[model samples]
Target: MSLSIGLVVHASRRGVFEEAVESLSGISLKWVTYGHERDIRPLVRSLVDGHALDGLLVGAVPYRACRDVLPPRLPVAVPRSSALDLALALSQAQVRGWQPVPVSIDTFDHEVVAEVTEALHLDRTRVTCLPYDDDQSVDDICAFHQRSLKEGSGYVITARTAVLRQLRGALRVLNGSPVPSSIRSELHELVSRVRHERAGASGFAAGVFCVGRHGRPGDLERSRTGLLHLLRATPELTDAWIEDRGRRGVLVLGRRTLFERFSRNWLVVPVLDQARESLGVRVAAGFGVGPSARTSVVLAERAAVRAESENRPCGYLMEDSGLVVGPMGPGGPPRTGLHRDQDDRDRDQGDRLRELARTVGLSTATLSRLAAIEQDLAGRTVTPSELADAMAITDPSGRRLLRKLHAHGLASSEGSAQTHRKGRPTGLYRLAIDAALTGSADGHPLTAV
Candidate 1:
């Protein structure tokens, strides 16, 4: 019997949505359409009751909606095309004689490691997985370095390549040889591929929606601040934002270039789709990325919603029209998991802000408004207040939004210090005051890159 798969989608994106469904394997496809007004549970439950779902393809399902609708162990796919794209990239990389050296901060079983090595045909002697905690022993570092210098050791797949930099200085004193350049190249490429797979094919931007008790201090602010910091720290981010709507979480935006730059040693978190378990003050996060802004945003929203719905931590990838909401890491709370998706989204948004800041010399807030204005006006240069007005929010809201954007290094403000006739002075925010605008900071390779 053919495996049955169900799809949840919006009416507007039906065509492309169906195409994504057709791309999946191990199942015959079934589709269920939903709009902003309708409840999705009936459709989801109908599929589960009538068919053995090999997987599900979903649009952004709010957490409450998912808990009310979905059944346990319902294998769902999301933004299905992304999965196929990853599979293709992996195949191409293999054909090109690129061997993968998977690295995780957490340790995998020896059997699992052996199997991975055998499948990839890597030199088992060269494949070393050294798991380290914050308090790493010097002896462990020396031993790993010694082994890395031996012949056939082509790659060092560790969570953070930057961490290896400090170790390299230590190793040169303890052992003569350094990490092979080839290994470094391979490791870089592997990280690039994983990020590429996450973004799924074409260049695109994503938005994440977090809604709940915005007044509750720390949960929302801490999540947003930590995410922003993480993204900016990573080299790959292109752009990002947090909605000024006083919602539970921030909405992030960015492109694949940003993701590709920062795929090293990310902390993974879980998002759950069930509501039966909720720890007191437990926190969960959701993730979504794709080849387009709309899809990526939708997927991420669903993942977050799932985490909220089931009162559990969950992480998800879009597969066709379904979302693969997953359990947290081994020994993690079912209802509480860390989310890397938000971090990725934050990085992308940071990249966007940085780019804008480089060109205009503005803070992240100004850059964010500029981006929104750019899109809202269909790619036209816009005034800051004009941009704010276009967002349909209050002046105070605009100010707060701009402040947040400023934090991202995307925009700037200039105006008389005297208070305006109405009340507080509103500065004229613009793109960052960068050399690009002044023509002084040009031709620098660091700026160019």
Candidate 2:
């Protein structure tokens, strides 16, 4: 099936959008375009819920603007302004006879600007790089540019499209757009990831096995060694671990097909029978199938307990609908079970949040911290001071992180709390957990994946 991808860009950048569409012609894609950056959140929510787009490609809109608003699981690709784009902007400035002696550049990363400056053989001292944060308004940006010009900057190069539009006639503006090649690269990556995830969502089966000595206390040590040896030799098992020495429970992970095959023909029965005969040991196995590895592990643990209760040398399968099918000894009834697709949506939501963290360049530690806070204080708003304490960072760093979240639409300032003293009110913020899960500010329930 052709993958459906939503393309978001400003309406004014129709030419660049068209160019991107043309460049991606070789791929089997159903491109849905959302022209206005301002209305992207609602449009993307509609596309995700109604049209079923596999992924999203956002251009023209800053990454921060769309990051928090879009559903976390809807793989989003945002193009970074490339070196080529900077090179072209510089070329335009030189063509217009703009002196490079004193240049004012705004909104581009300081590191990138430095690299470009060195590549272009421009004097670093003459260039003033004024990178704007998410809180800076157009007026604030324009004022910064105006101040730079008045302070002896002969030319201004800006990456902010709005600032460029407002100051074009007044300043020698070089508009920065994303490089087409960079956009194509990110799109290719997004498509590949979506394809992989779609394939993985089919679900897999896993299990846990409890092994114990049936004969005497002396045989316990021997049984553990034999069980570990057998598990290590089993190449069919994708993952195997002896979780507890005292309990002697082995966690095994594998494909559902393999488990089903073992259950139907009593293959596992014979294996356990042989172990009982040779080493005087018993094996109780429980199997589970789920949308994710974590969920499967949880179900497998429950299945293991049930297997021990049955006291049989047979495999048991736990279905998502809470049905248990097991004790498939020789000549048992044919295995019949149903798999539920209920948790697929929740798993997708998790995937989306991880992808969002990646796209926004958040560290794994930072993402984990956010998740912990969400879990501990479910519906309560948090202040920057509290968040800072939780994250073990400085107050300024905490405030900056909150601003970053707000910029990306992942958090909002609820209101301000009055302090007893005569200082400014403390800002209270709330994480947009519902928006992350449902893709709507109204907190609609997440749709099934």
Candidate 3:
């Protein structure tokens, strides 16, 4: 399938944007263009909501503009102004009989400008770097440039296309564009990342097995030992754990492709059969597929119950759409309908939860931990002590995590909890999971917290 990419650039830099688009001809590409950095956030949200693009290529906006406004889940590529671009601008200034000393630069961080200046054998003290801030307007930027010039800056170099367009012809402006090679490199990297994430979102399959009684302690131990040995021998089993120390069940997690391989080869059923034949122990198994760990666990538990009731050597595979596919014994058609019902209601719920994790820039593990805490609270506001206990982290760490969520607009502080007697009242917080996932948060685009 052709990868869809949205290109964001200022309207003034259409020529350079076209050059970038032309350079990406090697890939199967569908392009969507958005002009004006000010419209970037709304445009990107619209594109994502409409399912129009897989990734975004930020062509000519200031780096901070892209960083501050873009969604965390979308793969975004921003080509930086490299040292070579600075060197080329300096060379052009020298050719025009302009002294390289006392050069004023705008839209790049001060440290980067200094490093590039020193690397190119120029006096860093003579380079004045004015970094872009989201709060600063075009007039503020222009005034800064004018003030620098009045203060004896001989040449003005700008990396922002909007700033360049405004200062062009009126000043000795040396415009800097991201090098073509750099843009192509970033595009390749972003495309690879987008493809990987898309593959992950399709979900994986897992199974749980309740090891039946062997009627003797030693026999049961031997059976469990054999089961562990067999699991270790199966290279495709990504992870396996004896839930409740083998009292409740054994849980196994793996990709759908590997699970299908197990089914085709009769790997799991044979192992269970061997245990039954050699050790006189029976096994009840349940299988499930879902986008996240919590949903998989729930489905696997339900299937395990059904397997125990049926008393069958084979297990059932629960589809996302709620179809039960087996008493899947050895060579039982490999369980059909793996990806059926993409619009299944339960699958959509799991996808939305995973989307919330992505929107908050948290790992699935962290999201699960937070969900547990929320469940414990039972609609009451979260307190620091309760959060720390639920998350199994130190109080300070819990406070820091909560503050991070607030900063990302995923949580908000309600007043402090009332205390009868004490020093400082504990703070209360409410999470805005739905608001964040829907991109309706009041401030700040969600990014790494």
lDDT of 1 by residue, 1-449 (tens): 45555666555445644444444444466777665424567766776688765545453232224534555334332211111222333344456565543211112223224444555565566445443222334455445645654554233332222334445543322111112232223223323333334335345534343434444676666645554444344334445453432445555566633432332112223111211123122334454556567777777667666656655443333323232423222122223235345545445544534444322222233334344344335533334355556555566656544543333333443432434567534355554323233344332211000
RMSD per model, one decimal = 26.4, 15.1, 15.1
Best model per lDDT: 2
Model 3 segments more than 4 A misplaced: 23-51, 59-72, 200-251, 256-449
Higher-ranked by TM-score: 1 or 3? 3
Residue pairs with colliding backbones in model 2 are: 68-408, 72-352, 73-352
The C-alpha lDDT values of all candidates are 0.41, 0.62, 0.61
Off by over 4 Å in 1: 1-199, 205-245, 257-283, 310-314, 319-325, 328-449
Report the number of backbone clashes for model 2.
3
**Of the candidates numbered 1 and 2, which has the greater lDDT value?**
2
**Deviation of model 2 at 160, angstroms:** 2.4
- Superposed by TM-score, candidate 1 places the C-alpha of residue 279 at a distance from the truth, in angstroms, of 17
What lDDT tens digits, residue by residue, belong to model 2 across residues 40-80? 66765665677766777775344456666666556666565
| TM-score winner between candidates 2 and 3 | 2
Candidate 1 matches the true fold with a TM-score of 0.24
Candidate 3 per-residue C-alpha lDDT over 140-236 given as tens digits, one digit per residue, 9 for 90 to 100: 7777777777864487888766677788776778886665555666677678767755564456667787777656776667666666665566555
